[model samples]
Target: AEKGTDRSTLMDILWDVQRRKRYISEDDIGKIGQAFNMSKTELEGVITFYHFFSTTNRGKYTIYLNDSIVANQSGRKAIQRAFEEALGIKLGHVTPDNMFGLYRTPCIGLSDQEPSCLINFKPFTNLTRDRVFEIVTELKSGKRPSELCDIPKSIIHYTPAEERTVFFKPYRQFSSLSILNTYSPEEIIDLVKKSKLTGRGGAFFPTGLKWEFCRNNPSEIKYIICNADEGEPGTFKDRVLMEEHPELMIEGMIFAAYAVGASEGAIYLRAEYMYLRDRLEELLSKYRSQGYLGKGIKAKTPFDFDVYIHMGAGAYVCGEETALIHSMEGKRGEPGTREFFPVEKGFNDRPTIVNNVETLCAVPRILEMGISKYLSLGTKATPGTKLFSVSGDCSKPGMYEIEWGMKLRDFLDLIGAEDPCFILFNGFAGECLSEADFDREISGENLLAEHMQFRFKDPLEYARKMGGIGLRSGGSFMVFNKQRDLLKILKNVADFFVAESCGICVPCRTGNFLLNKKIDKLILGHAEQQDLDEIKEWSNIIKITSRCGLGKMSSTALNHAMLKFPEVFEKRISANTDFNKSFSLEGATADYDRIINEMTLDYD
Candidate 1:
């Protein structure tokens, strides 16, 4: 093995080894162990733990189909039918041409992308039969299609001519999310200060600022956490980071540990990421044994740091900082208020620092590239690139990283999305956008401002309002084509929110449950104008009164449904304006009883 290949290289070696045939045998394993200087037990542990690290040959193009709620809603079975019919293969079966391998993985964060499929390590979600065929044909021909595929002739004439710039390229290899191992606290801090990198895990907080805050705080045993539990719907960018560059994450954690005076670090990864977890653990062991970690000489100065991987027991709410801390402590993953930020009172009640997986992963580049260079590449307020899981109505769906301030058109083009019918920013519970919002830039300031403009409008006006509604933290845009029923789509989204909301507060728990019932009633061809009015009233009340960001965002579904897709509700209301459409007196109450009964899946 070559010396000083970096932590990520070790993971690459393991990945390469797993793809070989002879390595499956005991003798081959021993030889491989000797080559990498690893024990047989360690080698075997790594190979067996991960489901993806196969000893047999996988085709050049491997496909991972994730079965999740979004896929379920979008008729995932239909997507499978389309792919199999088009490709001449069944689930988990590859084509004879060796051009593709098919397998099933769990959900990627982008539920909209769920029923999500990976083609040659790239993601494509929100698939339709027609779209799937287009993708397969394009791939089969070895030509990657671009977002221009979705442009209608009416709109095409309005678009500007494609222009080239000196500094910017239309495409480039995504910068590897890796970092050099460093021990010195001052050195690590200096690197962070120079990189001008901001955290990719929601909030877009400047990473260097976070380190500076934790470093200045008075705490002897500070804790640093990498929030790897990517639970948001319509977002799956983090998983790619883990599978492709596990060591960059570790190096980032180590650098953060040093900067903040943290001796130990923990990665709170989601249970769904079992494959990534296995690969990461194997990489950690190998890197440690090679003196890449611990005191006295992985490289130069002495820096003692170690990382532990803790699996989360699948809860969406646990993505919150407080809840994550609770989960790590073996407690119920419920959140408390932000009276004392995690930086002041975190894990085990010690001064702690929690950063997202993407945030930690970006640390090394900041060290390598220096701050001024980093700052010059992105917008002034939000420097550095943002990663997005672009799926939904787009033809070529995948995770993309682009510098801040890039236009929405450029972004969609980079991700190869055809024109979107409607874009749902943030997560499932966020606002839905019409063509009116397409030209707007995606950024923290723009999203916030757009949402607030809708604060005082009628339902439709409010829905149409731009800004303040997009994903500044974590969210994906779900695209809907003209063929799809917008009303049914909104109801499907409402059903998911009602099902997932933890029954903590009345607004979220009871209120959301009721909202879904009303939407369902409208979809079933029975509802009154009064019913729609009541739903809106409840949305406002719950939105304002609910605790945490989840509840506040939950109302967005109802808000958008009323404003953006008013015809769905208005059609029923106009027919029953006289209040005589066979709605029983107990129609509202009885539905609640039924919903409560079916709340939990295991309520036997």
Candidate 2:
């Protein structure tokens, strides 16, 4: 805690080392361990647990190509092959020239413009074979990557508050940290509940209740954690909020700390947003300089709360609250059993409340304009507006904030999703609703459950329907047109869960692996009727027995895709019934076979 800040940052040290030296080394690890008073093995454990922390300086420019579903459908396979052939180096390897390191990442949040890559954390989207070569030529010619960077203006198209609230109102305005002195902590909690605010981080937990729990938990210390590790694929709204309106969020955190009796607050941002670190640090220092932060903020109340940002090192599972707590404490970012929630025990075993980035961003608006005005904006069940990251086959593929309960069809038309046939709601871990559900409203209420409730008068009779998929999103919705392959898309979704699973529980570890294998068999047309039954069995087992939310939702995309698009698999089975591989193999090996034959002429 030296530097007037909580410096328990393993991820930060690793990131600093990687940026400075291109990679981390064992000697560097020893020095870091000694400086931080940590075990050397523990330091290495943290590095290996994350995918972004590498140990070798393989190349000067690290190229992370997007291998997500959106990219693949947009001809990422051909683009990857083109890069391999042009560079003369296979993926996961650096060329002898030490120019580039090719790696595959899940998603860099640009599902709108697919076949994308991040050269040293800068995004380059909508890549063609020619464009890849052209960019490579520039990189090789000592050109900066930022020269080719495509920075879009206002990724969030509009602010919901408009001219009514101060969120997106004016530039560098004074945040209402002074307003916290006007209300007691209990009254503040009542205002949040009156606003009917809930967590926007997928779980839909009540934000007010969460704060109330930690506030009443009687501890020597408490913490407020804004979960900004927006690792969900196709989600980039948080990045825009964090980069553009960070002060609004910081003000929210300070208000939250005052309400919950927390001395410290932290914002855990993902490592992919590493470029914004210096700007955020400078903002914090500026606030501290003005007496809005550090001891006795505004000198009105004893709310000595300051916020810090923690970087997550490429683990999607850390989006879960408990797993995030573990990462912040310099341990493996894995979820623990949920007997005691974070409101009871979290972040150094202190009572803590974890709010999502959007949730925090929305807080300042509610506090300023009063809770009634916020509640009047959206549906009865879910009040206020929410942000959505719309991409995939959309004319305007960017962020938008709208009042909830809008028709799905109207949303598609507004965003210009031409010929939209499918909806991948809330990334791979969320639902896959079909075109038939276009008329459905995007609200907090689950439409399938509502349908079941109204259709069947009896609660027991509701179980008889084979069921349909409903969208319950945490503000991520991706649309794919009819030209995309449904089965292959599901396979990509399955592969993401398989790659991202924490493997802490058996159901997530083994179940997601088997689920992916079944998808592979279905894609290859080698699956039997028995395989379908086995998939159902495994999916149910994983959903029921998984220890954490990630494991429980691991098979969600597959299950929903199968329900909505069963014909994709059924047609593939008939096409592969009389599979012939001889001609295909021969066609692929034509040129290579002739060269090999010439080399072995004496044997021939």
Q: Which candidate is the best by lDDT?
A: 2
Show where candidate 1 strays beyond 4 Å: 1-70, 73-75, 78-197, 296-302, 413-419, 448-472, 565-568, 575-604
lDDT of candidate 2 over 1-604, digit per residue (tens): 2322234576676777887777898899888878777788877777878878888774778888878877776788888887887788899998897788888988776666677787877777778899988988898899987798665344556445574332345544355665776888888888887887877777665678678878899997999898888877888778778767888877778778888889888888787776677778888888888877788765235667787888888899888888999999877898877656787888898998888888887777788877777777767777677788887878887778777777788788878898998888777778787888888877766432332122335321222121111123566778888888787778888888888988888888999999889888888887766777888889999987887767777788788777788887677666666655334677888989998988899577
Judged by whole-model lDDT over C-alpha atoms, candidate 1 comes out at 0.62
Q: Which stretches of candidate 2 lie over 4 Å from their true place?
A: 1-7, 30-42, 78-86, 126-134, 141-148, 152-155, 158-172, 446-472, 579-604
lDDT of 1 by residue, 1-604 (tens): 6533332233345445544431255766676667666777866654554445555545666666665444655578888888889888898777887666666654555453455565543456556788888888777787642331221111011121222111112222223222333335665666676665555655444566667767877888788889998866667667767765666677778777767777777888875564466678887787678655555424334456777777664467667677778767644465655656566788877767778877876666555555676666556655566666655666555565666666776666655555455566665667777666667676544643543221343422322231112234564556665555666666766666665565567888888888888877776656777888898899888777766556667767568757876775677766655446665668769988788789865586
Worst 10 residues of 2 by lDDT: 462-471
Give one clash count per candidate, in the order shown.
17, 0
Per-residue error for 486 in candidate 1, Å, reads 2.6
lDDT, residue 238, candidate 2: 80
